[model samples]
Target: MITFNRVRSSILKAKDHRRQLLGIHETDVLRASIAEAPHFRALLSEIQAEAERARREPAPELSFTDFHLFAAQGTRIEYEKPYFERRGRLLALALEAWLHPEQKDLDALQNEIWMLCNEYSWALPAHLPYTLEGVASSRVTMPEVVDLFASETAHALAETLYLLEGRLNPWVVHRVREEIERRIFRPMFDTPNTFPWESSTNNWSAVCGGAVGMAALLLVDDRERLAGMTDRVIRAMGSFLEGYEDDGCCAEGVGYWNYGFGYYVYFAEMLYEFTNGKLNLLQGDKIRRIASFPAAVALTAPLYVNFSDCSETYVPNTGLVSRLHRRLGQPVPEMTAVPSLHADHCYRFPHTVRNLLWTDASLLHQPAAEGTFTFPDTAWIIDKHRLAGGLFAFAAKGGHNDEPHNHNDLGHFILHAAGETLLSDLGAGVYTRDYFREGRYTYLHNASEGHSVPLINGLPQAADREHEAAVLKQEVAPDSRLVYSLDLTGAYPKNSGLRSYIRTFEWSGQAEREEAHLRVNDSFTFAEAVNGVEEFFISLQRPILSPGSVTWRGQTGEVKLTYDADTFSAEAEVIESLDHGSHPLTVHRLRLRAGRVPGEASWSFLFTARAL
Candidate 1:
């Protein structure tokens, strides 16, 4: 275990104690580091073929016209997608050449880097110079933009220089270094107020700060300047921590947790390595609890709490989870060994590099965690069980409608059986300029109606911090069961006459048989009678709707939902959302509507999914 104390002692006892560097001190060491990795050489042919394909490709060019398009029209996919696609090729070829000199493609690497330097700005066209209203603004001084992609690009350039300094052209090297100073260092250290991301409390803070800090460590040799940068970074990281509640619940959902918090770990590891144990940011009660978040949300394998604009199935990042476990002793969430090297995204470069560099290969042998966990601060519950037939899991959340990356999904829940999503959350909608700038909540996934919650008076849930849920109580039993209740009065409009909505979930698993059951009881009270109340339970399978029950069958087996006929009526609609362009998915919105009536109502349902 690489504990803080051991690292500190090792640093003190070392002969030289020079700042640690990856494959930079010696070429042989670099070669060995790559050679020992099982993936390095095996991925060589794959990277080379990718390089050949990239060489044959036309270089992507972004003009002021592309920049102006987003400003004029809310269309980001046209320019941003191609822009990122181009970056993917550049990074892949560059890393390939540096990692293997025996089959190096120096010309390709240099060509890509030169083109990268020539781009108008590493920042996305949308992020170039814009007001909060999404209109393009004039930049008089150094651009104060610190976006996710731009920051990572800076670090990638700096780290590339650090590794292949002598091989690169002197003039090109000078240009890259000068650009880094002008674009990032000066704007960050000399005039930080010009940059807005430093104080951000979301993924922006961790990602932007981490990327800039990596560049500082790789390029800035002056201790005082480096110290100043680290100081500002510490401040920004505090804001990132503050973004989560005491429950360590990531309101951005686990996807951004993998994104925002992932960068937090990436940079934290880099700092620890550079400082030689003097600064171990991983040592803290909050950090440890924060590290345990994935375990709390993991339902069997890929399924998770897709609260906000997250996906129904979140792929596990094994390298990151392993590193977190080693550092904080958090259990490794269920994960498969998938290579993260060649993923094509701007935010992926720094992380992919670090994933290859920092991961502990031994953690791959660890088994997926099995248990039940709850976070009371955010009112999230996850229960995973290894039953007689297969895996039985369930997860849900009741938080504010106005969380970062939030959907108005208060009192939302998900049920999984045998690695199958029986009850689902549609996660995110397709990304468009309108998705962010226009009516975000107007979309089904962004609206309260998109989740497994009540559609009171045929109205969706409202947005903002004031709309939230109160966790009344919770219980996790040793008999393989969990129960929790939430009061969702503030999740809707006051005029909706929502006095209090108490939604309870009780999950129980059978040890001797291959069966798991959940009882959802919704007891609601209103100040005045309204049109009607419709309860929604979104599912991937087409539910057979009836008078007071619905059922769905899939690979996981049959899931039968039986409710009170006197209180509600059931209906199913096939809702198709095109948020993920090529992979436009569909869901069955099983609605249970109550007739317009009195001030109080009670809805009860028993959900059981059995494995055969």
Candidate 2:
């Protein structure tokens, strides 16, 4: 029952120690570079000027509502106040130190720097012990607090503090470090809680947590502590890699796929610098494919069939790709045709979408070939466009409901068609209050509706039969067209009598076109003969821009099938609006429920399409 107030108070009270611990004598690491490298000097000056402009502007007041809006949009707009202001100051001080290493009078700049850091520390009181209650109604537990506060805001602050050490109080750095370590790192490793950190199910825990750990190593000087921290980080990374089947698709949607993958790259870059390339993550074949995942999803028009909690507003992260290219010692490619946003400072590689798309052409042209497949816990895609193409992919389930940015879609799959995604999984939605974590929001993610499974008894598929239990059984097989299977019989209550649901996606790979037959079989044996079993449906949806058609063929049962392609266009219909100008490509939901209690029931659909 960690309250926001409690966390905030703890953070504030810890400030005194932070100031003392970070009080190291200043040393100008970048001093020689300023004079030796003109580009570095210019960049530093530019950063300082920007910081000055921010300082001159009046601080704007923002409410929790404003924060929610920015979070959802993935924009840091509200940072014009405290968070960004502090970051700007830190950048200025660091640049100033680089540009004027011998300056005897840095008093003014140092004062402003401390003021910003202290102000950030003060503001934590308002948002501490982060809780959904501030946004929702109920008081969440301590683990939830950790999840809420380990946000983009917190990450930004931690990064800024790490980057601008020495200019601010040593104690400030130590305090911020301790707060994050206790609230985020400790709980992540020591506790059984399943936010992003505990679940090795995906790469995000490794990436994001890895980045934080790198920051910690950068700021903390104790050799023993650093070794321990690095060991933990390596283990976490190992967990993420374990989730990577030789293929590369993350069970989490592409959006999370990007988030976790991006963090992996981020941490990898830091690890490269810290270890002088001795411990390179890019060396791994499975890990390297993660870099190209965005390209696979981008091959389809409008990018992906973001059926889960995904929106079209998300564009490719070209900057990340550019960074990867450099890290791997490749030439930076021309990228401008792809839709993208400007790269932020925190990102390791800051190229525009155009750059990545253009460079990724190499990946697309390599060849649509198939190769030896490895079945990790999940089936994922590594080189989706090569010999592996659609042949390589993974599927698995079992992430904590308490995981950061979790959806109730444990058994869902992301399918690639002829090197492009014909039927794909939707990623996450905007992080607004309305969309925060409500699993029942049909359009929010690849939950029950967004997936290829049947919903029995009209109840959402719970991971566990009991509210506190974990998922029943999630398994996959790569040898046959029966590529994967998931049995959620345990998700139901007791004596629901062998109530079992299984989904098998069989794929037939051909040069010109690929076929995917989705078979969902369910058996429910009630103690007493049940009455009217009415509501049921089979749904197959793709993003609007998908250049293929999906026809549903009924296999068994006497259920009426309806087609609502939401679009009037000959090609596809636009149904839901995700952003200002973007609409979710159309969704074709098929429903089949028991008209009356028949003894048992089953349903299936065969989805076939040609590569666009």
Error (Å) of candidate 1 at residue 481 is 4.0
Q: Against the hidden true structure, what lDDT does model 1 obtain? A: 0.73
Question: How does each model score on TM-score?
Answer: 0.91, 0.54
Q: Candidate 1 on 1-612: residue-level lDDT in tens?
A: 234344444434433323454423676685677667774454455556767787887777776676668767766666776677666776677667677666544776677778877776677766664543433444323243557777888888887787675777788788888888887787677863646676777888998888887787788766656666767776777778888777777877778888888878877877777766566778877788788887677765666767777775666566687678777888776664544445434426665565556566676644446777777777777887777656777887887876777788888888877767789888787776677755888888888887899877666788988988888878876774687888888898877777778998889887766788999998878777655788888888999877667888778566789988887777789987765443677878888878885788776789987875
lDDT of 2 by residue, 1-612 (tens): 223343233323332223322112233443453345432333444556754554565434435564454445433334434444444444454445435545555444555444543332222223333345654642333422443224333454465554455555666666666666655556544544445454555655565566556555455555445555555666666677666556564545556666677666666655555544445567755666665454444433333434344443344454466567655643222233333222233222212211322234332222222332333433332223222223322223433333334455544544444434433444554333345434335543535555444455555555431422233333334543434444555544354443444544444443433333333333344443552322223223432222223332222111121222231112323235343113344454433344334445443434443332
TM-score of 1: 0.91
lDDT of candidates 1 onward, in order: 0.73, 0.43
On lDDT, the leading prediction is 1
Cα misplacement distance, residue 431 of candidate 1 (Å) = 2.8
